[model samples]
Target: MSQTVFCRKYQQELEALPFPPLPGEKGQEIQRTVSKQAWEEWQAQQTRLINEKHLNLLDPQTREYLMEQMERFFDNRETDQAEGYVPPSR
Candidate 1:
């Protein structure tokens, strides 16, 4: 069975990531607190932000900005959205 964690974003027990998404303490923290579902959603949003804003991952500033956005996303705080993008209706 997959591991489970008390997701910080959802405030409930949910499936945890199999491994850290990045290297270092921040990644470990996320592995311990974030749910897989939440992480996946963040990935989709991150891709949207990159495509819409033309972000360059090689740039330190862009990486920092994305990190900040990731934290806000997991914290359930206000986060930036891609302009002119619409969510598909369920």
Candidate 2:
């Protein structure tokens, strides 16, 4: 039941799976599963940093800016999901 043992047992099986992994987990998830402790620690640190540092800079305008940039990136996934195009991309 320990993580390392599980990884050694199932890593190939997981990697050879036919379907795509979840979106955020597309590539790194196998390693993440294999290295659960490191992954959790890294995620915790990243969450702490993002929540404490970058998130503090956010405001209504900051939200708008993020919406703008994300909409523009990769051909406007945001606007399509928005039920309509939105904010006119700035």
Candidate 3:
């Protein structure tokens, strides 16, 4: 089940306590919160891991195209290193 569902269920149980918590009860809630947080953390980490490991493999033409795009971007940019010519905004 989703973390929200788990939290809601456990929260209901905590609220149904006989009286004030016995000090450590709050720790249980904190642990559940950490676990839910870790689940999301690990999920994002897994996505990054998958992309880094497998999904981002670049073929030759793709790499060439990316390089061409970068070159084009920098080509249109001006710097003091250029022939002192200012770029006109189109």
Candidate 4:
């Protein structure tokens, strides 16, 4: 059976990740409080942020920005978006 957690984003008990997405306290907190679905959502948002903003992963500033966004994302708070980005039409 999959591990379960009281997902902070969803406000319910749900399946949890098998391991933390990062090291240290933040990752531990995510493992304890974030759901698999929420994590997936963050992944999608992270991708969008990276692509839209043209972020360079090797840059420490970009990584720091992403980490801050990740925190806000899991906390159910608004995160910064790539300026002037428009969603592609379906």
Candidate 5:
């Protein structure tokens, strides 16, 4: 069975990631606190931000900006959105 974590984003028990998404303390922290569903949503948002903003990942500032956005996202705080992007109607 998959491990479950008290998701920091969803604020309830949910399926946890099988492994750390990054190296070091932050990855471990996320593995312990963030749900897999939340991580997947963040990845989709990150892709949209990168594509819409034409962000260059090679730039350190761009990486930092994305990281800040990720934190805000997980914390349920106000975060930047890709301009002119619309979600599909369900």
Candidate 6:
């Protein structure tokens, strides 16, 4: 059976991740608060940010930027977007 958590992003109980997505306190907080679905969504967005912005994750600055974006993402705060990105029409 899958675990469930009170997802801070979704504002309700939902399926939980088996482990934290990152290391240290932020990862622990995500484990306790973020849902699996939300994390997956962030992964997709992160990928877009990487590809569109040509972010080199190997660089410390890029990694730090992504970390901050990840925090804002889970907290439902406004996050930076890839330059020239256009949302697909529904």
Best by TM-score: 1
**lDDT of each model, Cα atoms only?**
0.97, 0.38, 0.37, 0.91, 0.96, 0.92
Candidate 5 lDDT over 16-72, as tens digits, reads 999999899999999999999999999999999999999999999999999999999
lDDT of 1: 0.97
| TM, every model | 0.96, 0.30, 0.25, 0.85, 0.96, 0.87
Off by over 4 Å in 6: 88-90
Q: How many pairs of residues in model 1 come into backbone collision?
A: 0
Clashes of 5: 0
Alpha carbon RMSD to native, model 4: 2.5
**CA lDDT of 13 in candidate 1?**
96
Per-residue alpha-carbon lDDT of candidate 6 for residues 3-88, written as tens digits (9 for 90 to 100): 99999889999999999888999788889999999999899889999999999989999999998998899889999888888879
lDDT of 2 at 90: 56
Worst 10 residues of 3 by lDDT: 13-22
Across 6-63, the per-residue lDDT of candidate 4 in tens digits comes to: 9999999999999998899989888999999999989988998999888999999999
Task: Indicate the residue-level lDDT of 70 in model 4.
Answer: 92
Report the lDDT tens digits of candidate 2 across residue range 6-90.
Answer: 3332233223323322355633453444334333433454344345445543478654654353323323133212222233455
Ranking by lDDT: 1, 5, 6, 4, 2, 3
Residue 31 C-alpha lDDT in model 2: 49
Superior candidate under TM-score, 1 versus 4: 1
Least lDDT summed over 10 consecutive residues: which range in candidate 6?
A: 79-88
lDDT of 3 at 9: 21
Return whichever of 2 and 6 wins on TM-score.
6
Cα RMSD, each candidate: 0.7, 14.4, 20.3, 2.5, 0.8, 1.6
For candidate 3, the TM-score is 0.25
